[model samples]
Every structure is written in structure tokens, then in C-alpha cells.
Target: MPRIVLHDYFRSSASYRVRIALNLKGLAYDQHPVSLVAGEQQSPEYKALNPQGFVPMVEIDGERVTQSLAIFDRLDALVEEPPFVPSDPPGRAHVLALALTVACDIHPLNNLRVLRYLKTELGQPQEAVDAWYRHWVVEGLAALEALAAPQAGTFLYGDQLSMADICLVPQLYNGRRFDVPMDAYPTLLRAEAATLALAPVEAAHPDRQETAQ
Candidate 1:
């Protein structure tokens, strides 16, 4: 098999999602840290590799792919067993809906770039920026809690760990970072606890992947 390489920032939720997918697929890969705080992602050489200068850029099968959701899908396709995504159309729809609630709706607003813009360009204080992060997190997770509360089992969609759980664990990590109150989403917390118990999911945690200074 060709070597799999991942370019990611330790704190990026987008990068974190790809890490979970790779672990679930049981693939061994090299991770190259890109320090978003130090602006490593904006370096010309890195931008040449990923025009968008995004973290979680992955090289698989000699092809470079960007976007965590796209990488998540590719990994599911590459490995059949221990699938991160569902096969049935209805199952896929439900899982993607939950995943997108985090990946698309929640993540972008609180992304590093957006937060930087809020603090630097928009001239918001750290307290205000942190409040911004918490507000959106609470809003999105509240809706997600309602959606998953009805059908969630050990994982978001059922007993099987699907893409929904993969997307969720990292976002929950972020929620904790900004001190977002989590008790409002008990179902999400339950799924997160179960997902984190999995050896693969544990391996993917950002704390485990941090680059030594």
C-alpha cells in the first residue's frame, strides 16, 4: 500500500474528523503538523499543495484530497468493514444529516479563520470571541440533541458507529474548550462517551496526536 500522509493542526476540528476516520479504517499514516497559530498553513509551499491552505489535507493513493467530509467519504469507500458511513440510502441520509449538523452548520462559524477574523479584524475582545463560539455551539448542539435523542443508541444512529459519531466527538471537544454548557445535550454526551471508549476513536483524539515542541 502507498504511504498515507496527513497534514493537520492538532486543534482543528476538521483535521480531527479525518483522524477519527483513518483510525476507524485501521490505516497507518504519517501526520505532519501544521501550526495554524504560527500561520504554517498560509506558507506558499503548503498553499501550493492545498490551494485553500486548509489543514487535514491528505495524500492517499498518490492523490491529495482536501475537506474533511470528502476525506471521510473516501476513507469509508477505501475500507469496507468497520464502516464509518452507512450503506442503505435511508441510513446514509440520517447519518449524513447528523454529521452535517456538525461538519457544515456548526464547524465553519467557529473555525480558526473565522475566530481570528472576529478577534483581529473585527476587533472583538477574547471574551467576546469566546462568547461567539459558545453561542453557535449551543445553538447547533441543541438542535442536534433533539435529532439524535430519539434514535440514538450507543452511537448516534444505533449501536454501530457511523459518520455522525465521527463528526461529533471532535466538536464536543471544542465545546468543552470554549466552556459551552454540555448538560443540555445528554444524548450527545452519551454517544460521545461510547464512541470515545472505542480504541480507534481514542487513538484519534487531538491530545494523543499533539506534536512535541
Candidate 2:
């Protein structure tokens, strides 16, 4: 096995997703912290490795990979146990839909850069920015709650752990951090609770990371 180096921030949800996948696959890796708040991601050297200029940049035996979803797929392909993605087509689509609801719809809206733009560039107060965060979180989670309420069992999409579960646990963590109203999403909460109980998921929590501050 080759050395895996993960360039990540402790609290980044994207990085958290990859951490869960790596832990679930039982792959050990070294973590190099990239402080998103300190602007370490924008340094020219890191940008050369990941033009996206974000955490969760994975270096496998010196080869680089970016994007959480792509990394998850690659891990699934590399380590053959407990597929991170679903095996069936419809199952895969449904899981990806749920995952994207967090990745594309909810996360980008509330990430550090966007919120910083709201506060610094637009001259919005922290309260206004928090309101903005809550708005998008509520909107996206509402739809996800509906989609998940029907299918949720021990995890999203029934008892088996899938990409949906992997994506969701981190989002719920973010929701808690922002104090998003979550009572309406009972099914999502249930699945989140179950997912967090897994040893790998617990180990991947942001607070447990080496760089957590």
C-alpha cells in the first residue's frame, strides 16, 4: 500500500466526508492541515496541487486528487469492502441525489468563502450572514427530509450504509454548528444518529481530527 496524504481542514465538511470514507475502508493516511481561515489554501504551492483551493486534497503516493465525491468513488474502487456507493442504478441515483442536496445545494451556500463575502465584501453583519446560512440550510434540508423520510431505515436508503449516509452525517454536524432548526427533519436526524454510531464515522468527526482547534 502506498502512503496517503490528506490535505484537509478539521472542520471542513468536504474533508469530513473523505475522512469517513477512508476510515470506513480501513485505510490509514497522514493528515496535513490546511487552515482555511488562515488562507493557507490560497498559497501558490497548494493551488498547484489543487486549483480548487480547498481542503480535502488527497495525495495518494504523491499523486493528487481533489473533490470529495470523486475521492469517495475512487476509494470505493480501490478498497473493495462495503461499497461507499450503492451497487444498483436507481439506488445509486437516489443516494447521489441526497448527497448532492448537501454538496451542491446546501454546502456551497454556507461555506467560509461565501459567508466571508457576505460579511466582508457585502458589509453584512454576522447576524445577517447567519440568517442567510439558515435560509439555505432550511430550504435544502426540507427537501432532503422529504426524500429521506420515506426511505430511511437504519440509514438513508434502508439498512445498508451508502453514499447518502456518508454525505449526510457531516451536513448534520454543520447544521448543529449553525443552530439550524432541525426538528422538522426527523428522518434525517434518525439516520444521522445511526450513522454516527458507527466506529469509523465517530472517528472521522471534526473534533477528533489532529488539526481540530
Tens digits of per-residue lDDT for model 2, 1-213: 768999999899999999999999999999989999899999998998889898898888888889999888888878888897678888889888989898999999999999999999999999999999999989999999898777778888888888788889989899889898789988888888888999999999999987788
Candidate 2's TM-score reads 0.97
Candidate 1's C-alpha runs over 4 A off are none
Tell me the tens digit of each residue's lDDT in model 1 across 76-162: 778776887678988889999999999888999998899999999999999999999999999999999998888889899988898
Clash total of candidate 1: 0
Q: Which ten residues in a row have the lowest lDDT in candidate 2?
A: 148-157
The TM-scores of all predictions, comma-separated, are 0.96, 0.97
